[model samples]
Target: MDRRRVIDLEEFADELRRDPHPVYARLRAQGPVHRVRLPGSDPDYATWLVVGYEEARAALADPRLAKDGHKIGATFLDEEMIGKHLLATDPPQHTRLRALVTRAFTMRRVERLRPRIQQITDDLLDEMLPRGRADLIEALAFPLPITVICELLGVPDMDRAEFRKMSTEVVAPTSSQSEYDAVVRLAEYLTGLIEDKRCSRPTDDLLSDLLRTTAEDGDRLSAQELRGMAYLLLIAGHETTVNLIGNGVHALLTHPDQLAALRADMSLLDGAVEEMLRYEGPVHSATFRYAAEPLEIAGTLIEQGDHLVVGLTASGRDGGRYDDPDRFDIRRDARGHLAFGHGIHFCLGAPLARLEGRTAVGTLLQRAPELALDGTPGEWLPGLLMRGMRSLPVRW
Candidate 1:
């Protein structure tokens, strides 16, 4: 622990949130890992930000840096509001949870969902493209994945705008009380949904399958764990992809050359999405992980119990990892970018996200050849965990 040299990140919180690449560049120039105070962290709690590509990648998969906070006497909002789920567990617990969830989630792979994803994209475009001008985030990006995840989880149609409001608050709260209320509401809703599923005849939804799933040893997801899984899936499932689409489109709109290249030859659509993820990923940073025990990262000591936040956005733009890192090129070989992360905690929804992005961007370009930015993005989501626009205005 470097008690004498702690970089306070709250000092430039605004700049960091709006455009973090410059800040990441400055920090990466200094070293791979640094002890710092995040914008909204507890003042007394120590935290480190890993920025270098190699170090950030390694730290993500390091066993010493455990995902379970309870092991080190720490806790996060998710554990308190929901219950312990995949991200909040370690070892045997995590292994068991991942295995069970994987059984349910991966059964329907990305290829199987291609037609439906394309249909969803086309439907959304049909509604929005005719309007000529609209907020892309609200019109297409947000709804596509939310609809998919909700249907997968068997959530009945309700007030989507309200749900969006609640989910957004949980991820990027304006106040602690707001976040608490949002989490409570979500907890109540999921509890009711789970109970409804319990009472009703079994369905093919993931949540329903989870309720019925049992391990070889007869272990099953408790009610609390079920709710946790649902909450994680509902929130993380759509939110990350929301940004991937919003950010990817934003990158293209900002860089017309790349957009034109994609429009000229749709074959680059897949690679373009990869570059978009590399250039401006939806996940700004990996969720908070604690050092289970003392560890060394890039020659710096990360004391036991200290928190680590690997800068996914920073690593994506690492000059050492890519030539002309800051330049956005659809043709770049962005195969190893940490956009979806790497390791046990790697996003299970990567294939789904890629499918959605490819379909969404490809279909939109095919339908709206004259699409152009109507105005600047409304406002970046207010958090380091998620990087997305609240509203992306566009005209076609």
Candidate 2:
């Protein structure tokens, strides 16, 4: 067992926060799975981090690696306050919740928003381009999807600045107390938002549609379920796309050849976005997955009740899967990457994210022909869950 290394994950926090790729690459070389502690976690609080491409793909769909917080002895997130959202539940329950949300989050529905999405993108660009230089995260990357999701969910009064803080903390909590506080505040806010939606006259927004939606058995989402669904859609919808835009733009700006290739052929936009997700997906690791029973991943034995974090970013860049995995190639096939994840929990909003990503990146290139990095890299989000830049400075 000496071949397997036991390292304190916190020891690598600063380096990982800057660019986790190198660390992940080194770990993948040793093995796909590792026992490590997360930031702010106890020295003894090591969990399994799956970084190999194949191992991560299988682990994501593995039933033994469950999402039920109760099964894992979790101390951070409370299912009652958060409700059993898609990420926090398993099949049967997960199956039902996904079915309900999928009814309103259909691809057809998302496709219909293309024109409006373009209009929003164009309008945001108009405001951003004139500034000549700006932090892309604030100016464009963040606002576009937040606006799209808010309008989609019938949330017209969203405070982007406030929501960003709570959402970031929830995704990568610094401590249990901070996580609890943010979740409580967010839950309260969403609860009020849902109450208002229920009392108001029905509208065409997705949230309203969900309010009136009924299954074939005449079933409907409970008050808590509605809150959970709203919370999931509002947060997950915007966060993933935000980082996708930021990371994708950063990748392009840093790699001129690939950027020029994309600029030469705007048709490569779809593939380019796929490449971006594969190269550096927004989610560094899939949310907490706990072992329901003893199991082995990549030959490493995981004990029952052990927590697991699937390395979505590591898996996408695995050399065994992609030739020259580290190289950013916009035109590469880039298929089968686990950026949106795999199996039942695959990202529900992938279509919406892809639509937004393509529009945001493609249009930005068309408008800002001379777009370039305005400064050196900024700090990356410090956690195993979210992988993205805090801000991306850019100039046209």
Task: Assess every candidate by TM-score.
Answer: 0.97, 0.96
TM-score of model number 2 = 0.96
lDDT of 1 by residue, 1-396 (tens): 365588989887998889999999999989888888889878865589999999988988898898988888887776887898877887889898888888778836556778888888888988887778999999999999999889878899979999999999988888899998899999999999999999999998888989998888998889999999999899988988999999999899999999999898989988999999999999889988998888898889888888889999999999999999999999999999999988898888888888888888888888888988997788787878888888899998
Over 4 Å off, model 1: 107-109
| Poorest lDDT segment (10 consecutive residues) of candidate 1 | 104-113
lDDT values for all models: 0.88, 0.89
- Number of backbone-clashing residue pairs for each candidate, in the order shown: 0, 0
Candidate 2 lDDT over residue span 1-396, tens digit each: 232456787778888888788989999888888887787677667778899999999999999888987776674364678687898889888999889888888889999999999999999999999999999999888999999999999997666898888888887777778888889998898888888988998899999999988989988899888888888888889999999999999999999999999999999999999999999999988988999999988677888988889989889888999999999998899989998899999999999999999999999999999999999767888778888888999999
